[model samples]
Target chain A: MVKGLLDWIDERFKIRDLWNDFADRPIPGGSSWFYVLGASLIFIFSLQMVTGILLAMYYAPTPDHAYASVKFIEEVAPFGSFVRGLHHWGASFMMVLVGLHMVRVFVFGAYKKPREIIWVLGVGLIAIVGGFAFTGYLLPWDQKAYWATVVGTNVAGTVPVVGGVLLRIVRGGTELGAFSLSRFFAIHTYILPWSLALLAGLHVFLLERAGAGGIWNAADRVPYKAEPLFPNQLFKDTVFIGMVFIALASMAVLFPAPLEPQADPTDSTYNPRPEWYFYFVFQMLKIFEGKLELLGTVILPNLGVAALLLIPFIDRSPERDPAKRKLMMAAGALFVATVIGLTIAGARAPIVNAPAVTSPSVLAGRAIYARNGCSACHGIFGKGGKIGPELTHVAARRPDAAWHLKHFRNPQAIVPGSIMPKLDLSDRELQELTDYMLSLK
Target chain B: MSDQDVSRRNFMIRTIIGIGAFIGAAISVPLAGFGILPVLRKKEPDWTDAGTAGDLMTDEPQERRFFQTVKNGWQEERVERTVWLVKKADGGITAFSPNCPHLGCGYRWFSQERQFKCPCHASLFAIDGKVISGPAPRALDTLSAKIESGKVLVKFEIFQVGTTKKAAA
Candidate 1:
C-alpha cells in the first residue's frame, strides 16, 4: 500500500529520483570524521530556528514587559526552561561547528578553485549568524543584556564620521528602551533568519555542484578516490549529530539558561562584558583605547573580514595540500591562535569596578528619573536645564512624599498650574524615585 | 540441538527489547512530565508585613518596601514590592497597592497637594484612596490588612494592571 502511494506521488513529482540525486551523491575517499562539521552546523542551525520560534511565541518585545515575559517562559511555561536551554547551548554549538568547518575548508585548500563562491557564502553566513547572536542577546532585557548593549552601541558611536548616526540607528534612539527592544526583536526573529536561510541554501547548492575537495593524494599528485555518499558518509554524519544531541540534552538538563536581574538602564555599577565569542573584540577595545579606538573597533575587524572573503581570489594556487600552501596555513593558524589567546585573556581579566554606591533602590530611582527625561527641565546637583526648580533639596523643602507623588501623577493637582509633565512609572518605580528624592536631603 | 538453539535466540531477543523499552521510558516519561506540569500548577499568594501602625502619621500616606520570593516554572527570584500605608483620622488603617487604578503606573503621594498622583496618565486619588480625577476608572485597590501587636500585616496580591475593576492576577 505504501509503495503504491509513493509511486503515485513519484509519477508527477519525481520524488524517488530527487531523493537519489540528493542522498546518493558521490563523496571523496579522504572523507573522515572531520567532514561531519558542515552537516553538524546545518543540523544545529535548524535546531536554533525551531527553538527560537518556540521562544518567540511567549517573548514580549517591549521594555516594560520583556523581562517579565521571559521570566514567565522560564518559570511558568511547560518545558519552556529546557527549550530555552537548548536554544542557548545550540547557539554556542553552531558557532563552534561553523568555526571548525571553516578551518577544515581553509586547511584543505577547498577554497582554491571553482569553490570561491561557496567560501564567500560561508563567510556571509558567519556574519549573519553573529548578527543573530548579538540581536537575540538583548531580547530578555536583563542586566547583562542592557549593559552589554550600552557598551556595544557606544563602540559603534566611535566610528569616524557616521559614528553618531550608526549608534542612533542601532539603538533606535539616544538610549536603549522600547524602540531598541522592538528593533532587535524584528531583526533577530525576522530579518536575519530569512537572510541566513537563503544564504545557506545557496551555500549548499554550490557545495554540491563543486563536490567535496578531497585531501590531495601526494603520490598521484591528484585528488583522493571517490565514494558514494549514501550509506558511508551520511551514516557517519548521523552518528555525529546523535552524539551532539546527547551532549546538548545533557547540558540542558544540568545547567539550564540563567535569568539575571531585570535590565536597569539607570544602574551605573554594572560591568558590561560581551559574550565569549566577542571577547576577543572586547579585549581589542581595551588595548586600543582613546585615539586608537577606531583602529580596533572598525579598521582591523573589517580588514579581517575582507581578507577572509577575498582569500579565493588572492591565492590562486592549484595545490590542494597544506604543505604546498605554507603562507595561507601559517596565517590561518596565527589568526586562530591570536583569537583564542585574546578570548582567554579577556575572560581572565579582573572585573573593573565602577564607583560604589550604597542603596540599590536609590540608584534605581535616579535611573528612573533620567529615563523619564526629568533632567531635561529640572536641575539636579547643579547639572541640567534650569527651567524647573532645582530638585537637589526638594525633599527637605516639601518633606511630604504624598505631595511629590500627587504632583508627579498630575502636576496641576499639587501646583495648581504646574507645567511639569506627568511621568508614568510602575508602582516599584514610583517608590524608587520617592526614595531617591527623600535621600537628596 | 536446533530446537534448543532457537529457543535461546528468542529469549535473548526478548530480553534486549525489554531492556531497551525500560531505558526509553526512564528517559522520556520524566522529560514529558517536566514539559507539561507547569501548565497545571497554581500560583499561591504570600502575606507580608508592611510596617507598624505607629510608624505612619495620622492622615498621611507612607511608602513601605519589601522583597517577596517569586517562583515561576524553573526560576526562583526575590522581587521588590511596594505599598502605600495610610493612617486615617478615624484611627482606622488602610493599605493600598502602589499601582494606579488607570494604566498600572505607580501613583505617588504629593505631600503638598495631600493627594496621590499618577504621572503616566494623570490619574489622581485623595489621601484616603478615592479617585479624585483623571483617567482612573475606580478607586485604588486596597489589600487585606490586620494589626497584630503594633505591626501591620497585609496580604499581598497582584491585580491585573490596566483593568477598570480590581481583578486578581
Candidate 2:
C-alpha cells in the first residue's frame, strides 16, 4: 500500500519536476555585451506596450481633445508622468538597441547561412520602427509634430510620378486633415504593433532553433561548447533589463518631454526636421536630389534593405570570426562609416533664409499654404491645431527674409528635437511662403 | 569482440535513446503551448457597417448607436457604441465616431465653428469633422451606415488598434 501511494505521487509530479530543469549554451564574453542589446530592446518594447495600454485607457484620438487628454494623463493620473516617460524613453531605447543589434549581427556574421530570413526580418523591424517614429511624433499634437509632418509629406511628393499618389495616400488627401491623422493613428497604435509582435515571435523562435553561434566559432581555436542557459545566461538578461530600466529612469528625470506651442497653418515659413536617426538619410537625399533623387530617396533605401536580407546568401563561407572575414569586415565598416558621415553632413547642412518678396508672392504664399496641407501641423489663427505653431503672428515673431529662409531650410536647427522633415521646395515657393507668413499680423 | 562487451554496448545505446526522448518531449511541451496561442486568440476583424441611410439628416451631425455580437473563438461578446453620421450639403454621408480624436472624449457639434468640437481639450472640428483645432490625431471615422425600411442601423465592435492597419470592426 505504501509503495503504491509513493508511485502515484511521483506520477502526478513528473511534469512539474521536468520544467525545473534548465540548459546552458556557451555565450562568449563579446556576445555577452551584444546579447544585452537584443534583450534590452525586448525589455523596452514590452515596457512601451504596457504603458501605451495604460495611456489608451484614457486617451482620446479626436483632434479637439487629444492634447487635453495627454495633459490630464501627465497632471492628474497616478504615476501617469512616469508611465508616459517610460513610453517616451522606451522608443529611444528601441532605436539605440536596433542600431546596436544590427552592428552586433554584422560584426559577428550572425546574419549568414540559414539566417537571411532573420536579417530581412531585422530590416522589416527597422521599417516598423520608422513607422513608429513617424506616428509617435504626431501624438503630442504640438508644433514639432505638425510642421515635421508637413515637411515630411512635402518630401514624399518629390518622388516623381508615383510621388503624388504616394503623398496623397500618406497624407490621406491633398490636405493633412482628419483622414490623414486617422490613418496614421490606426497604423501607429493598432497595426504596426501587432505585426511587430508576431514577427518578433518568429524571429526569436528561429534564433533558438539555430542555437547560439557559440564564441568558439568566432575564436578559431576554442571549439564551441553548450552551456546551461538559465542561471548562467538568463540571469544576465535579468540584470541587463534592470540596468536598462535605471538608464531610462535617469533620462526621464534629466529631461522631461517638452510641450511646444500650437501649430499655426498660416505660418508658411515653418521649420521642420526629422529625428536624429533619419538625419543621415535626409542629408544624403538632399545631395542626391540634385541627380538621382528618386534613387536616393526610395530605390536606394530599398536596395539597402535587399542587401541586408541577402547578406546570408552572399556570405557563403562559414567563418564566423570577424578577424577571418576581411571582406565582410571592410564592407561593414564602410557601410557604418558612410551612414555616420551622412549623419554628420545632415547635421552640418546649412539653413538658408527665405528670399525677400513683395505683395503678390504673399497672396500666392497663402494659396500654397492652403493647398499643401500645412494646416494639419501648423495652426491658422490662435485657433486650429498645435503640431507646429500658431502662425497668425509668425510675421511679427520672425520678420526677416533670411530668418524665414533658414526656417524652411532646416527646422531642427532652430528647434531641436522637432520631427519636421526638410522639404524640397522651389525657391519661388519658399520666398512666397515666407512673404505670406511674415505678412501674418 | 567479447560477448559481454557486445551486450554492454547494446544496453548503453538504449539508455541514451530513452534519455534523449525525455529531453525532446520536455522541450516540445512549451512549444506546444506557444503554438496554441494563435488558434486560441480572438477572431480577426471583419468589415462592419454602422447605421441606416436616410436616418442621417443632411447638413447636421447625428449620433447613431450601433450594436454587434462578435464571436471570438468559443466566446462571444455583444458590443455597442454611439458613432457620428454626417450628411453633407452635397447629399453625401460620412460615418465617424462621436468619440473625440484626442483622448476619446465625446465631441459635440459647435454651431459657432460650424463643427464638431471636443470640449475637454478645446479641440474644434469643421462642419465635416475636419480638425480645425485641438489634439485629435485623426478625423472622425466614417461609420458604415445602411438603411432598412427607413430605419438607421449601426454595427459596433471591440477592436484593438496599435502600430498596424487592422481594425476589429
Winning candidate number (lDDT): 1
Give i-RMS (Å) per prediction.
Answer: 7.4, 15.2
Q: lDDT by residue for model 1 over A100-176, one digit each (tens)?
A: 99999999888978999999999999999899888988989999899888888777877888977888899998789
The local distance difference test score of model 2 is: 0.68
Model 2 per-residue lDDT tens digits across residues A1-441: 997887798798775354344233445432364566676677677767766776676566656656666766565554556567767777878887898889888888778777767777888888888788888877666677777787677667767678768888988887666677778878888998998888887777677667665453545445633444544455455566666777786675576555566556555455566667778777866776434767777787778888877788888887778999989889889888888899888877775443433357878987888777788788753234668876865776677888778878798886788777675688899888888887774
Q: What's the TM-score of chain A alone for every prediction? A: 0.81, 0.75
Candidate topping TM-score: 1
Native interface contacts kept by each candidate, as a fraction: 0.12, 0.00
Residue B47 displacement (Å), model 1: 17
On DockQ, the candidate that comes out on top is 1
**After aligning candidate 2 to the native by TM-score, how far in Å is the CA of A332 from where it should be?**
1.1
Candidate 2, which segments miss by more than 4 Å at Cα? Answer: A1-31, A216-224, A350-441, B1-169
- TM-scores across all candidates? 0.63, 0.57
